[model samples]
Target: MTESPRPSEGRSGGAQPAADLARIVVFAAFTAVLGTFPGIYLAGAAVPIVLQNTGPLLAGSLLGARRGAASVLLLLVLVALGLPLLSGGRGGIAPFFGPSGGFLVGWIASALVVGLIVSAARRPTLAVLLPANLAGIAVDYLFGVPFMAQAIGDLRAAGVASLGYLPGDLAKIVLVSLVAAAVHRAFPNSLPRRKAAAKA
Candidate 1:
């Protein structure tokens, strides 16, 4: 009679919960560090050209939803505490209430959405990248537009101001997708395969 393998074998055999948690912590720190780049000051507005979104996107694509969201949350907390870890090295609660505050708050949701989509979709091909990035970017705008409108109390003004940033944000999304694809290829094992495992 052949004996069946123990529960600790096969899929559960190599699972390391502690190591996974440690990796999440380390990646969260890395996300915060990557957010320290400065923004470009325009005529009457500040345009952030930092690699901030890239970090969150990559974290989501590589860390799965919960850990990815945790990373963004940690970064946001640091910024709220005046860490000067945001674009243009701007931090403190003031930014959280400023014109760009909505976008800042939305980043967490955006990362969550991106990570969720990436995990749920199974295949991370080009088709999936477009929708994933678009959803993530849309989440950012959803928060940003309303906040900017409230800050200025002029819907048209807010929309026009936001237009100045559309091109840049789109470019950032493109770059993020590219980087995500590369990471998926080279470090496929980096992200936890919750969706795939379940389907299997």
Candidate 2:
């Protein structure tokens, strides 16, 4: 029986592992910056909503699945540890289990989903980009709305409350996708290079 050769033997070489780790760190820091940026604020809800999804979207597009998820989870851990890494300087484990809990969880899941889509697409033009952002938005809404309803004890009110932020969220999705595409063009190898090399 023949055994397949290891990746380093066939590809870039022994340095690939270190290179990959460096990319992971860079992406994680990028997400941290986006998460910490205090964007538009939605007050008086379960927790104030901010245009922080840009971090998840950009991470997924540029970092791909595993690493993108890691970036978001890293931010989550920081927030949970009371680092005030979230938008408007909100943090702590309570937010994770509070009204904003689902949205927080959604960040990880949505990053994964976006990464899966963007990675599979190989080359993300504007045509293919919006859908990926929408997927993350849907995930955010899927988890967030229910939690809001539960927390506020009124589904209608929660739905209405969420509407206030819809425009801002949509705007963030567009901005993030454009920036991600630009970064992808610039970095080219920021994401896992498997799919891209295959296409090339």
Candidate 3:
């Protein structure tokens, strides 16, 4: 079996890994910054609605699958270490074991899926980008619901509880689609090189 080339083995190879690493760190920090903004915590909701997910979306759209997922994983690791990186400065092992744990696990997969879509398409416009982002959102719920169900002890009820997040997630999809598409179009070089075509 052939191994994939290392980042250092590619064109402009020496700096490729560093570049990818930088992008990953930057986006992880971006998500952390988003979390610093206020969140809406519903009385019955297990997790607060925050802008943190948007960071993963942008990282995926611009950085491709691997780096995008890495960015999420990085942020999660920090949270696990009790860095207080989450929205409202909330983070720690406690959150992971709480109702929000599943969603936390979902972030990595969500970013991978979103980046794969953009990479597969070769050209991502708002029309296509929004749906891809929506799919990522769905991926998040898939991971979240089961964990929530386990915590709540009612599978059906967990699904019902997650509904409150739909509206906010939908808004994020729209906002991310616009911003990602614009970034691809206006400053294509800013995005990771695998996907997201440069504006002609």
Candidate 4:
């Protein structure tokens, strides 16, 4: 007679999709919660420095590429639906057309890059996560600067103005790296496994 598959094996396959869905929902909600924190506006600056940016960094570092990007996209979809899900209760298609629009759009790419970098490692450590998070921040600024330049009618000034975000962003990188590293330590499987190289 054929034997039944082990209970553990049966459960593992079924549980994976549920776990993935749960993580996606949790991170998306986590980002929305971060937006509840008031944003900091720099002197004479149109855009505010917001903690919500960290959500992508954390999501990518913890969830890996596909799920991380999905989380950010989910939040953006809600925002597009006119939910006050952004910092200071801002939302809708308006924010997407505003000075901060590029940054918002860049978040998906930033998370994708961060996840790709971190997942390359066998284990996510502080050193690996730090650079991964920094790269994500760079992606964000890349998109944000040009949009701000266009909005303000001053490319040079927009570049300079973005400098104000450095201090806070650096702090976030450190914080996220530490947190991600700790989480990975506690749960080794939290990050995605690196793909094996194909045979020639």
The TM-score leader among the candidates is 3
Q: What does candidate 1's lDDT look like per residue over 1-200, in tens digits?
A: 01122334224212666655666668767876776655555465655456776677767766766667666777788788888777667789998889979988887788788877887776676567667878888888899999999999988898999888887778877877888888788887666655347457
Task: Write down the lDDT of every candidate, Cα atoms only.
Answer: 0.73, 0.73, 0.80, 0.83
**What TM-score goes with each of the models?**
0.81, 0.80, 0.85, 0.83
Distance (Å) between predicted and true CA of 95, model 4? Answer: 1.0
Between prediction 1 and prediction 4, the one with superior TM-score is 4
The digit string of per-residue lDDT tens for model 3 on 127-199 reads 7789889988899999999999999899988988888788889989999999999989887665455422332
Name the lDDT of candidate 2. 0.73
Off by over 4 Å in 3: 1-15, 40-48, 194-200
lDDT of 2 at 14: 25
Which clashing pairs does model 1 show? Answer: 38-88, 39-88
Ranking by lDDT: 4, 3, 2, 1
Where model 2 places Cα greater than 4 Å from the true spot, the runs are 1-17, 41-49, 195-200
Give lDDT tens digits, candidate 4, residues 67-102.
788889888998999999988898899999987698
The model with the greater lDDT, 1 or 3, is 3
Residue-level lDDT of model 2, residues 40-157, one tens digit each, is 4455555445556678888787777666777777778877888877766668898877765877888888888888888778487766678998888888788888988999899998
